[model samples]
Target: MVSPMLSMNQATIKHADLRQTLDTLTQTGYHSVGLWREPVEAIGVPEAVRMVSDSGLCVSSMCRGGFFTMPEGPERRAAIDDNRRLIEETSAFGCTVLVLVVGGLPQGSKDLAEARSRVAEALAELEADALAAGVTLAIEPLHPMYCTDRACVSTLDEALDIAAPFNPKAVGVVVDTFHVFWDPNVLRSIARAGREGRIAAYQVCDYRTPLEADPLLSRHYPGEGVIDFKALTQAVAATGWHGDIECEIFNRAVWDTPFDEVSRHVADAFDKYVAPYWPAE
Candidate 1:
């Protein structure tokens, strides 16, 4: 049997709309899903909520709401406001975690430190709203390769540091293997995230060396790449957090496959690479 803890992140089947995403997951034995903003918005939140509610799949989190790398200006202000709306949508789904892919450096700007500082500033601006909504803004640090264009926060430790000043319930970190598995300090950071009450989400995927041209799409099924899922899963379990484990693959080729086929593969991969290390419920 597939472990009930498994959750299919909607990104794993990017071509599917809200209904297809939900139907495919439930039909494939998944008990939950990690949501993304675009798909939820494509069908509108009200309709999306109805479909999700009827699907019987738990909502693990909302995929993203951060791109505050732009310096303070009208653009940055708008980004923060949009995040508030995203937080409300997350709450509407009865989910509390909102994963943040904090943006990398701004156009024509090269100061990495300044960009990171702005992320902290943005969090401060949004924390009150997050706390009020009972949602946690889960900062997701992408791998260093993405530092130039995707996420500036490139390590678990950095994510935690950005989350440090805010209340854990309002601001926390997302431990995603595609992004964090490469960190030598990752295990310690994961333990610290748990200790600090900052582990809002745990996403799994593998990373292989010969990355795709579009490196963001390089995520692979667990055990297919070099990641050590057993060690990562064991560390996360030891922290006493039993949240849903999301299999969030982003490969374009995976997206082209039939949803059911992709899902079966994800399930099998998780069973081989992850489930055994997960403690019994």
Candidate 2:
């Protein structure tokens, strides 16, 4: 079987400098790298562009540009403006998709329905700009656990619903195993996303059992946890997804490991757990 093209999300080596990260990715044979906004902004957009361009690596996607659940006021306005800028940045990086973690409930509010409504509204506001920038806004549904604070859109079905009214070229959904694996409807939702032509990105990471104190950092490398990568990968492949499959881990241990070591481990994990399911050449 042919292996899917592999990309490493920057969060997997959050501590590594851009040059070092790109060097390791190229040396390790990664086809692409997922750039994060924080690090890109830190180095300045022009420098970041030149570094990635010089590395001769494709950008899988940019992380991220959403947080629109705030009530209408300065905060919400600022988020919209920031997202417009992110769209520009994503274009500058030569990346086609911009991942969006639509914000959770607004401060002091418990209404999930209302919070989600705000996300849809915000997407509508940003759709024109995204289209103009030629960047697809890929809404990433975080795990339900983060619905209260990180992202209210916690399921692929929900993300699709939000993207339905917009042009698929301008908006779509992100399929991340760590967040959606636990959902019973994930397979169907993935298929729906594929049928609708809204599968913008597929991010791979394992879910470690026995939740950590801060569940945000609980993601593990593909084969180290309870997730059935083979099954999940096959499901995603069934959608005929042709984009990069990014390995995005958030474990503290992984963060502490050397970038080269992490790169080797990730490549091994992808081969062992995911590559076999890819379509045969």
Q: Identify the runs in model 2 with alpha carbons over 4 angstroms from their true place.
A: 1-4
What is the TM-score of candidate 1?
Answer: 0.98
Error of 2 at 146 (Å): 0.6
Each model's total of backbone clashes: 0, 0
Q: Best by lDDT, which number?
A: 1
User: What C-alpha lDDT, on a 0 to 100 scale, does residue 98 get in candidate 2?
Assistant: 99
Assess every candidate by TM-score. Answer: 0.98, 0.97
Cα lDDT of model 2 overall? 0.90
**Candidate 2 weakest lDDT stretch, 10 residues:** 1-10
Go through the candidates in order and give each one's C-alpha lDDT: 0.91, 0.90
Give the distance in Å from residue 217's predicted Cα in candidate 2 to where it truly belongs.
Answer: 0.6
lDDT of 2 by residue, 65-113 (tens): 8998989999899999999999999999879999999988887999999
Residue pairs with backbone overlap in model 1? none
Root-mean-square deviation of candidate 2: 1.5
The Cα error of candidate 2 at residue 159, in Å, is 0.7
